[model samples]
Target: MRTGGGTGAGAALVYGTGLAQGLALVCFPAASSILTAPTGYDLSPSRYGLMFAPQVVLAITAAALTPVLARRWTLQRVLVAGLVANLLAMVLLVLSQAPAPSGGAYLLLLAATGALGFGFGSCVSALNTFAAALVPGREDRSVLTLNVLLGLGTALAPMLIAVLLPRWWLLPVGVCVGLVLAIAVAWRVRLDPGPAAGPTAGTPKAVLPGRFWWYAAAVVLYGITETLFGNWSSLYLSGQRGLGVATASAALAAFWACVTVGRVIVAVLPARIPATAVYLLLPVLIVGANVAVSGASTAATAVLAYAAAGLACSAMLPLSISFAGREFPRLGATSAGELIAGYQIGYGVAAFGVAPLMAATGLALSGVYLVGAAVAAVLAAVAAVITRSGRRPDPSVPATPPVTTATRSDVPERP
Candidate 1:
């Protein structure tokens, strides 16, 4: 598979993936209203939750399978397939909006979400690899920039829903059409493919370093904390906090907006500021934000707290991935794909595990943000341990030599 490509094409591809992810992420919250409007299917909460299960499961499956698939398909092909899957998902969603047989609508919605998950998982793995390769030594900026596009997509979803719902049930269909056009544009852009998977002395196929697992653990926690807010915050605001539907949606938008804004801030910071310092500070801020969100007596306070949480949580995943890439320089793409899989695992847990707890606890769900905050604390501790230990390498594990373009033809050209 070809790996190098023009920087312009690579950026376009990455940004497209981000927008696809954003649109897919909003499906859950948007569905809450989309499935209940006068012309809609009126799905129950259990049924709505069931629709998400397949998306998360299938997405995890797709992400786990990417490394294997990359062995045969070009990275560009894999990305194109992902975009095609997203297109199919959007078509399914549009069909779901049309009048359908009694139970078929729910099934259509399920298929749409599942396809979306597959698309998202595939694109996420591919794009992160591409981003890491794009800037070479400055992976933090590339990853952050990529995620900022993603955050923009996520932030736009709720705002679109707020503006177009009820009267414009078909607005998402139009959005999907735009996405399909964007995908077509991306398809025409030639780019580098993923690196081949092979065992090398510098990058062993057998044993991974211990610190890799530490990074994975942090990613898992980051997923839990981020998903807790992204997935549940709307329900918490409307159902528990007694905010109006539009207001709650706005708050959700606020959370993602702050996330996007925070990424921009992190991206521009002086490289002299250690990433570890940023990592250490975020968890404390996240914990405090969660505390404020849980105790918030008014909608305004809760919205502000959720936004604060977004800012606090923004840099964790991208920076963690960047750190892992630096630590395992020889296996940058592989390490990224693996850590992302770890992230999806955590996402699956949060989606499946937390919802039931919320249902069982009812009003007590308001306190669930604390659990996320606590997880963030664990993540902070893990980062600290990794930082202290990373100064000295273990004798048992051999240090891998850094990868070079001559060594791997598939590594993309630096922008």
Candidate 2:
């Protein structure tokens, strides 16, 4: 399974982008306090929530177009393009700091989020493809590793924002520098992301098989579940639970830290434990974690609950992308993009969707979390269906020989 120097370099660059993307992606949400503070951006709950509306729209569009763009432009070029967009997002965030919290500042924030959405969509899709193709037989572990780094970035976001409090713009500025370096390296290094390259790039296949909808449905649900925590946990803790801003930020950091830790645990789990089992089990945990968070009153209790939710959410996205790649060999790297689009759809539903419900019904976030538990239940049902059948390995990637040892991943074929 040795890779050439170029492939290894490409893989490093791709994985690094995952971390950078994670940081940039969470910057806005992680600074939720500042955005909504009366003296800060002066954004209301609805306006703050609505900021991501454009992000969801553009992210889905960019993700959906990844395959088409890869076909026409090549995966390396697409990755670089995504990085450029990511840089623009950071730049916009920095510029938004220049204006006072007026319509002008708010509009800039909206634009920044929209750019972030597009960058996230394109960058994550391409990174997933490269991660799988670069590692061949180890696609599952590779994807998990990539996402572990992503989770690490997410974990760092809240803490970093807290540390650099009045200097929030510095975070995005730092991200811009990292992205610039990644783009430079990626632009020069040639990456052959298996079938997405010239060989089958021109091949016209069904845009997506009907079966993809199963993975899509699972991830969309997952998106809703994760966003409930990722986007709103800080606000929920600070506003509803009556915690200090710094304490709430710590709780958010704890949640994402546990996410990274959980992903690491999943990656190293004994091979006998089936991935599908882990996948199915996570949503069920998410269901329970939601209930725990909803009921938590004290800082310690809320932090612990958030940590549990993070662990529950840790591996769903990576597993979804990995399973989709295994199931649709012909689609190659593009399969990740389609799955990402589905996830963004869920993100949209939860991101902008919950705000209106609260504004219209005067419901509290605690109640919203209760509704999330129900969503996670449905997600578990979808996971059951997705994992019911064994994976069909990708033909392009060389399959590892079946291991003889009893491993953590082993499970009965039927539930």
Instruction: For residues 1-415, write the lDDT of model 1, one tens digit per residue.
Output: 3223437766776766677677666755665776755456777777777888878787777776666566556455667777788878878887775555358888888888888888877877777767766655566777788888888887877667667756554556765776677677666766643332212334334346766799889888888888887777767888877887766776777888999999988888875676667877887887787787788768788789889988998888887776666555545345666777788888877877886777787636567888777887888798787666654433233653444322212222222
Q: What is the TM-score of each predicted model, taking all chains together?
A: 0.87, 0.90
- Residue 301 of model 1: what lDDT? 89
Best by lDDT: 2
| C-alpha lDDT (0 to 100) for residue 117 of candidate 2 | 87
Model 2 misplaced regions, further than 4 Å:
1-6, 195-201, 359-363, 392-415
The C-alpha stretches of model 1 lying farther than 4 A from their native spots are 1-4, 167-171, 182-187, 193-207, 358-363, 391-415
Q: Give the clashing residue pairs of candidate 1, or none.
A: 2-193, 3-192, 3-193
Estimate the lDDT of model 1. 0.71
| lDDT of each residue in 1-415, candidate 2, tens digit only | 2332237677778789999999998898888878989878889987988888888998999998888888778766778888998899899888887685889988888888888888998999988878776654566787798999988988788778878989877899899999999987886677757643322456674366666788889999999998898778767988988887766776778888999999999989877678878988999999999999999889899889999998999999998887777666557657888889999999888877887889898989999999999999999998887788645443443553332223323321100
State candidate 1's TM-score.
Answer: 0.87
* CA error at residue 345 for candidate 2, angstroms: 1.0
